[model samples]
Target: MRLTIDHRTTYRFTAPQGRVVQLLRMTPRNTHDQTVAAWDINIDCDARLREHRDGFGNITTMLYAEGPLSGIEISVSGEVVTSSSSGVLHGTFEPLPAALFLRSTPATHAEPALAAFAQAATVGRAPIAALHALNAAVHERFTLVDGRPEAGLTVTAAFARETATARDLAQMFVAAARAAGFPARYVTGYCDALPNGRPTPHGWADAWVEGLGWVGFDPTLGRSPEAHHVRVAVALDAAGCSPVAGSRLGEGREWLDVEVQVSGQD
Candidate 1:
């Protein structure tokens, strides 16, 4: 399958700023199952973009802009070709050991209730089957919602809700999988399966199975990711792999708008 993606993020501030700096994990890397064919990032204003890799081995771009500016627009467009991998990752860069993903971040901390739920959901099953069960359980537990995820929402809080955004569901799955004794991490990427375009990129989880290495899981879809999924960044939690994280020197208030479109063809 060939996939095309167009993503734009805009930030408008009530007060002009002196400077802005951002770290972006919006670029996808090539793996055995997916190949980046073409990619570009455009900033509406004068800015400097430096490419580098983060600790998690994700391709990152650092943006620096001088201000007195009211707003900034960051746009990214790309094309990628992917093949069905049955959710098993291969030929991807791995900078850290799988055990590192087992470490929990604040956003993915599993409280007692969540931990117990994980235990109950996966009991009496083999590792792979248990992971599938946990994924389905997480999917069944929430009413999937769309739009930007609530900032700083933790897994425990999200798990308590009857509705959750993709980010929340992914984080919940990561937390639960870790509690179930599986080394898991959060993933931020794009999926071509949505009928309508989305305002934000997709989110999911990946777990390290002993014999299988890393395998993808989408609690939002209640299945493993395949050709329709374009894998990007992976980290202990969403914040660690956020597509954009930045700070402005001056700030009164700011409004953000995001638009994303992902389409695929065989």
Candidate 2:
């Protein structure tokens, strides 16, 4: 399958800002499951973009803009050809060991509730089977809420609400997978499976299997990602895998807006 993606992010500040810096994890790399045919990033203002690879082997761009300015716009577009990989990541770079992902972050720390739930879901099961069960269990446990969370909520908080955004859902999945003795990481990218070709950025979990390597599980969709899931970045937590993150100088208040469109090709 072939897919085209367009993602734009706009930032508006109530007061004029002096400088803006951003880390962009919006580029997808070539892997066994997908090939990047073309990709580009554009900014409304003059800025320098430096490319690097993060510890999780994700392509990252460092963006810098000097401003006595009020706002900035960043746009990214790309075409990718993808094939089904049965959720296994092949031909992907892994600079960090899988065990590194076992380390918990505040957002993904398995609290008592999470630990008990994971234990109940995977007790006495084999690794692969237990991972699958945990994935399905998480899917059944929480509803996918529309829109972003008002704030970045921890996995435990999201699990308690009975509804969660994709990021929180992935965090919950990662926490549960770790509690079940599987090394898991958070993945962020674009997904083309939404209704009416309405593209949205997505988050999922990757669990390391003894023989299968890194296998993806998307609890928001209650299954593994396939051709429609475009993998971009992976990290121990959502903050680290965020599509865009950075700091600004001289800010009173800032507002952000994001728009995305994804469509399938014939």
Candidate 3:
């Protein structure tokens, strides 16, 4: 299957800012299982960008802006073609390794609730069924409520409390996988193809099987990502795998707006 993706992020900072720097995880990685037919990341402003691969072999871009700037906008657009390989990533520069993923991060720490869930999960069943049970349980039992950030609460704790955003959902998925003895990792990317290349809603989770290696799962969709999914970065949490992470050397408050769009390969 083939997929096309376009993701754009807009930032508005108050007053004149001195320096701005952001790390962008925009490139669709080429993995042993997924092939990159064609991919390119375009930047609107004339700033500096440096490319680097993270510990997980995810392609990352470090960007910085200089001088008093009103706002900063970064847009990424690309296309990729993928073929199924028994859920194993092959024939690509980066293959999801076991070491990089198994390790826990701030957002992926396992708690008692997740451990108990993993213990109760129908392990003998197929991965899809198990994952479906997890998703359905999460969706049905918990209420998706919006509120201020939790007071230093981890994703597992949030699940116990029944509140989260798309990011928190991803975290919970990771913790559950870890509890199940799966070397799960967190992923961030675009969802359904939005019109005019507009950025759309997204979610992530862990994918590890006894023989299938690491795959992509969306608890939001309750299934492993097929052709519709366009993967960007994978880490232990939202902060670790954030598509954009950086700091702005400015005073007062700042505003940020992010948008994304993912489309199927034509």
Q: List TM-scores for all candidates, in order.
A: 0.98, 0.96, 0.83
Q: What does candidate 2 score on TM?
A: 0.96
Residue 24 CA error for candidate 1 (Å)?
0.7
Best first by lDDT, ranked: 1, 2, 3
Ranked candidates (TM-score, high to low): 1, 2, 3
Question: lDDT tens string, model 2, 21-102?
Answer: 9999999999999999999999999899999998788999999999886999999999999988788889888988888888
- Whole-structure CA lDDT of model 3: 0.67
Candidate 1 residue spans exceeding 4 A from truth:
195-199
- The runs of at least 3 residues in candidate 2 whose Cα sits more than 4 Å from the true structure, single-residue gaps closed, are 195-198
Q: Which of candidates 1 and 2 is the stronger one according to TM-score?
A: 1
Angstrom error at residue 21, model 2: 1.2
| Cα-based lDDT at residue 252, candidate 2 | 90
Q: 134 in model 2: Cα distance from truth in Å? A: 0.9
Candidate that beats the other on lDDT, 1 or 3, i.e. the better one: 1
Using TM-score as the measure, the top candidate is 1
lDDT of 3 by residue, 100-216 (tens): 666777666787867787657747868756765665555555545433234345776677675566567667877887776677777777666322333454657756676655667
C-alpha lDDT values of all predictions: 0.93, 0.87, 0.67
* Pairs of residues clashing in candidate 2: none
